[model samples]
Target chain A: MEESKQEIRLPRLGEPAPDFEAPTTHGTIRLDDYKGSWLVLFSHPADFTPVCTTEFMAFAEIYEELQKRGVELLGISVDSITSHIAWVRNVEEKAGVKIPFPIIADLNKEVAGRFGMVHPGQSKTETVRCVFVIDPNQIVRAMIYYPLTTGRNMAEVLRLIDALQTIDQHGVATPANWKPGDMVIVPPPNTQEMAKERLKQRYECVDWYFCKKKL
Target chain B: MGCISPDGTPTESGKKMLLALQKGLRSPQDIAKETGLPLFRVRSGLRDIAVAGLAEQKDDSYELSPKGTELVASLL
Candidate 1:
């Protein structure tokens, strides 16, 4: 039955995100340092690559806005800091967006392997584009894996972060194709009486079982 | 100092240890436990024992050589 649905091989989700302590141009950073804050742990292909350059620029432009929402970004690639520095410099000069986040020097690929980013069948020397959004409590809220050729949607990433946070904080869920400012799913009624009462109320909600409330 | 060069060296204990690790052992503590050596020494040995396609670290542990485990056995 499960196979009938697409055979999805996903990374470890709903658990503690993998911890990494690696040297960067900004010196060492332990994954635990971002424990109390939301984290966007992302992986990229080889350095100085064109597609990855655009993704980096997009993330950099929105880095501050993400932080305003109490989130941090950490980038990883299987390249040395020398390569990473050169790539960032090129992106900054050509793309005109300076990266504010630190890029991990995963030359040994320890952290990449831990996160299962190294999809050898796709590309042996490169990592498939992967992003993990982890909440403050160390649980993975969402994950996205992209093909090497197709660039990721940066705005969608921000929207997902917003959606997840909203549902979590409001004790609700989002409807299909949910976006910011859209109505959210109301919590299922606990008792039959409450269910009947919920149906009678007009809350922009469609039905008692599946109800929605404006963000 | 008894040291193995990062890039080049014919064969050292560290290299041998990496071979031993690739053959079967996973954790440095497990390798140390099997080798009857100090845990710290095992970690120090691995820092310089960078053999391509030899070993991979996983889940806060290490993985053995994916293939050619039999060829590695001749050394032990």
Candidate 2:
């Protein structure tokens, strides 16, 4: 039976995010619609669950902040469109935070399976918590997954988006636990001569293999 | 670190431990016995699982967290 359905493959870093058209709570939307803007494509196990509810509320809180940076958010689950609408309404009424983004109704599991959101061992019917950060060019920049019991950290997600955008604009990588205004890591030197020269440069170097410079 | 690659993939022993967890084995000794891996290797793999948030340590045993179960399913 599983063989009858199309196989789903998760997109890797530096690869183009898979494009698809699906019915969402806001309306029908496509991956192409998000072109020229960064996107956060995330999936939860199911709608109305406690963990998912908290995550949605958190995502809603950051929606405007993300928009300010030219980023959009798209959420997905195996639930029906009606369920999504009801959940959004319920959440808004209870939490008073509007969900500005569209929630894709991936009833067929086409999108979920394609994104490897559905883990048979976990539930066989529900998606695990998954997040994909795609850049404006549609290239996937990062992927994060969490267990059902753990709600995602919204601050970390925003920080990652900022880090990715910074790297994109400056062509430099961020150091561990990087935040805005933090010194970013310089790309490692490719040749021994360059490595030797790098040490003499002004950047702070823990070693030739590691160096950080102010952006 | 030894059980997981830099890219976040589980090494061979890591995969074995995950498989054992999927089969409902929770104790480190049980996982080692089920996968025929050494006790130290099983423990190392369990640590990787915990680090990845795929499993949780409860008392003296380890159990597959939702993320770990999902990973094992995806592997299958």
Candidate 3:
């Protein structure tokens, strides 16, 4: 008998995001279409569930703010386009929050399979909450996952974007709980010569290996 | 069909998308509908044209930039 199992390919940071063409609430979309913008490709278990609903509202609330930061949001689930549309309309009618982003309706699970959104250990039928932060060049910058029972925190998502953009803009790493205006961690020197010279610079330093600087 | 080349030249579909925008089509869906192109093609074309400095994004819509308008006029 032939083997029945297939290996799941999860996305990794610094790798190109898996390209996909799928039907969305806005219309048919492809990963290539977002070539010039940062994308937050997030997946929910379903459309009408309580936790997903709340997450949708929160995503809606940050839609404009994300746009201002040159980020676009694309949601996904295994639900049909009909279900996605109806749920969006319902959210607008009852929750009064307009979902401004496009949502991919992965009825065939093609996208979920590519991104490994469905964890068989958790549930076979539904996808877990997953987020892939893709940069403008279509590289997967970060990935976050949550169980079915939990909703995502929008602030953390925003902060992650800020951190990545800051790293790209200023060539520095962000510390834990790092927000904008906080001192950024400088890269440690590889050479002893540079290490000695690094201490002479006007940056906050605990040691040669650890230094923080203001951009 | 592909929309734009890596060097920023507009392919056939990209040109059609730009013409659609010149005819007052703004959103990607609208451009796709008007040009009879796939939504993905329209969107990818829009991004490519924007990168080539031929288009500008305004909120949820896109429009031909001054450079884009000049290019279209020269093509005509």
Candidate 4:
């Protein structure tokens, strides 16, 4: 007798994001609605928690910067819509900063389960901090996971988005500590002749395999 | 390379340890227990924090240095 197996699909780099429609603070949002813009889909454990509160505030502060780069932010938690609304109101009133993004209320863990945010070893009922940087085409470009105790680096998140957009525009990779206006790595040459030619290229080359050029 | 190690960014465990340190969780064992991370990973994170000049060892416990405090403050 053959046993039936369930296929598990996790969103990965260079692959399409798992689409979903969910209720949010702003309204019910669908993944396809953000088709032409980059999306940062992030998950937190719960609202009203200290670490999660700080993260939400940080994300709110960077809302404009992300928008300027044509990127949108979507926050998700396994909390009800009522709780999300109240928390957003409380945060805005206390912090005096406007949260211009919609936060998804994944009360049933539907979105969380689909995104693999619920790590049993971490906490069965809470979602760990997970960030998925999806490109304009809905491809998962980069992913970062943080435990519940940690708050994410907003600067690093912005930098990653910039790097992803840069790579999309130019077929190149970023080097360590790469920021905007920094030298970017050139794609490695496939052929020996190309490698030899790469060394003679105008870009600064530490070696044939490692060449960097300014954007 | 950036000031952060292991790909110029703190690993997840390192981040967790740093947050715990910011909250006055000084002992590595305490951080491990609080953050639900393995003791070895917590120790590794503490070492990374020290190397980054974010924390200082005092006897068997650790505390955030001035620079580390400043860094955490800037995050908020």
Candidate 5:
């Protein structure tokens, strides 16, 4: 029974993210170095790809906003440092956006393998689109995996960080398709009487079955 | 070899990719016959973990990614 448990487990989510040391074009970075901050650990399929170029540029365009939220961005790929350097430079030159953060050269794919970024049948050596949001403690707060055929939603990523922060501050969950400034979902009452009272309480509801309380 | 231990062994770089060749297994019967997984659990775990990108379709069959294979192999 114990032997069966030796299998590879999912990355611990909503907990501290795993730490690693990897060489980049500038230098090596240990994942733990960014404590007390949020990390957007995202991956792309490969260097010199068109869709990935647009995504990176979009991230670069919003770099300051993410930084203002006390979050750091860590991009990774199986490409070598030289390839990463060339790709970033190529994107900067062609797209006119300076990629401001460090990109991990996961040539050995240690980080990718750990994170389940490499979907072999999809593209063996290439990473599919995956974004992991990790809080200061390193626990992954959110994970979004996209197929090799699709690009990720950048706006949603930022919005999620905002939503997560809002929830942490107010102890309320966001409603479906929630955006900033939208009403939050209040927790239900602890007792049956309270639950009955809650149904009577004035809140937005298609019915009590799908009710939402604003904080 | 494509056969991995229950330890989530990393594929030895050039190991035969048995999974990459699988097409959609369609049902628990196929998954059970092909993967040796229990019919009931394979169907449900497929639905549950599919949201997390576990089982994926290739042409018409089901296969596991290196990472997903590592994940399930470990669960064994």
Candidate 6:
């Protein structure tokens, strides 16, 4: 069993996300059901905890924003469905914020194991904080992991989604710390002839290989 | 499916959405605004409502079918 656990494959970026069907606070949901939209599949350490509660509230705050961007949020942890329901209700009552998204009650840890959320060194029985940004095509676009002590930055999450969608829609890469409406990095030229033309074009080019453009 | 029971009864949010439709809200956005449910939930609920034959869509708007009208009448 230990050997098999060691061999558990962590999902990689640009690969199909491992499929899952799990019961949630809302109902049973399948990964395939979210194929036509972007999904932010995230796992927290445990429910009713301080950091996770704040995080849930933060997520609720951005739920509509994510919806506007055609993204869905699904949270998970190695907690029972009843526990999830109680905790979400508690959060709603105390924080006066509604959790609009579904949260997977991964009591069996099957989904956690598939996503590599269970880090033995972090907590053998609980999942670590992990985030997987999957595109509309169901491909894993990005992955982020946070240690148990630190809470995640929700703004960065929105920014990355913006970056991914911008990249897809405009066919350009975002520069470091890119945000919406910011200048985008153009694909660099490979051939010398193309390189010469790149500088002559209507872009902000430091050189033939480095160019940025406003979209 | 999220807001519908296996036997096709509308759950809380589903009932709210159907109620919004009974109030003559047609678009998902309008239903969401009227019911205060998340727009995503409203949209997903619309799909399930149509699947259950309770609502029908025309263009971007939705209204109750005869079955839906009867159900809402009973829900009251």
lDDT score, residue A141, model 6?
97
Q: How would you encode candidate 3's per-residue C-alpha lDDT over A1-215 as one tens digit per residue?
A: 99566567898899999989887876567898888789999999998899999999999999888878889899999999889999999999998989988889998889999999999777777889999999999999999999998899999999999999999999999999999899999999999999999999999999988999998
* Error at B67, model 1, angstroms: 51
Across all candidates, the chain A TM-score values are 0.90, 0.94, 0.97, 0.95, 0.88, 0.96
Off by over 4 Å in 2: A1-8, B1-76
Q: Clash number for every model? A: 0, 0, 0, 0, 12, 0
Best-to-worst lDDT order: 6, 3, 2, 4, 1, 5
Q: Using DockQ as the measure, which candidate wins?
A: 6
Candidate 3 pairs with clashing backbones: none
Best by lDDT: 6
TM-score of each: 0.68, 0.71, 0.77, 0.71, 0.67, 0.80
Off by over 4 Å in 4: A1-9, B1-76
TM-score for predicted model 1 compared with the true structure = 0.68
Q: What is the C-alpha lDDT of each candidate?
A: 0.73, 0.84, 0.87, 0.82, 0.70, 0.88
What tens digits encode model 1's per-residue C-alpha lDDT throughout B1-76? 1124435441455445656576454766677667654343455444434243345666646655553244355546
Best by TM-score: 6
**Model 4 reproduced share of reference interface contacts:** 0.00
Q: Which lDDT tens digits does candidate 5 get at residues A1-215? A: 56432223357666667668776543455676556578899999988988888888988887888877878888999999889999999987887889987788999889888887887767877888989998877788899989877878878988999988888888878877898888878765677777677778788766444567665
Please give the lDDT score at residue A162 for candidate 1: 88
- Among residues 3 or more apart in sequence or in different chains, the pairs in candidate 2 whose N, CA or C atoms overlap within 3 Å are none
RMSD of each: 13.1, 21.0, 8.9, 20.5, 19.2, 4.4
Candidate 2 C-alpha lDDT tens digits along A4-117: 543446778998888787877654567766666788999998988999999999999999899788788999999998899899999999989788778889988988877778
Instruction: Residues A1-215, candidate 1: write the lDDT tens digits.
Output: 56342222445678888767776644355676566678898999888888998899899988978977878788998999899989888888887889877788899888888787877767777778999998888787788989788788988888888888898888888877888888888888999999999988777656778777775
Give the runs in model 5 whose Cα sits over 4 Å from its true position. A1-9, A197-211, B1-76
Clashing pairs in 1: none
Fnat for every candidate: 0.00, 0.00, 0.23, 0.00, 0.00, 0.23
- Which digits, one per residue and each the tens of the lDDT, describe model 4 over residues B1-76? 1124545455555666677888873787788778876443455457667877889999868999898888777655
Which 10-residue span in candidate 3 chain A carries the lowest summed lDDT? A3-12
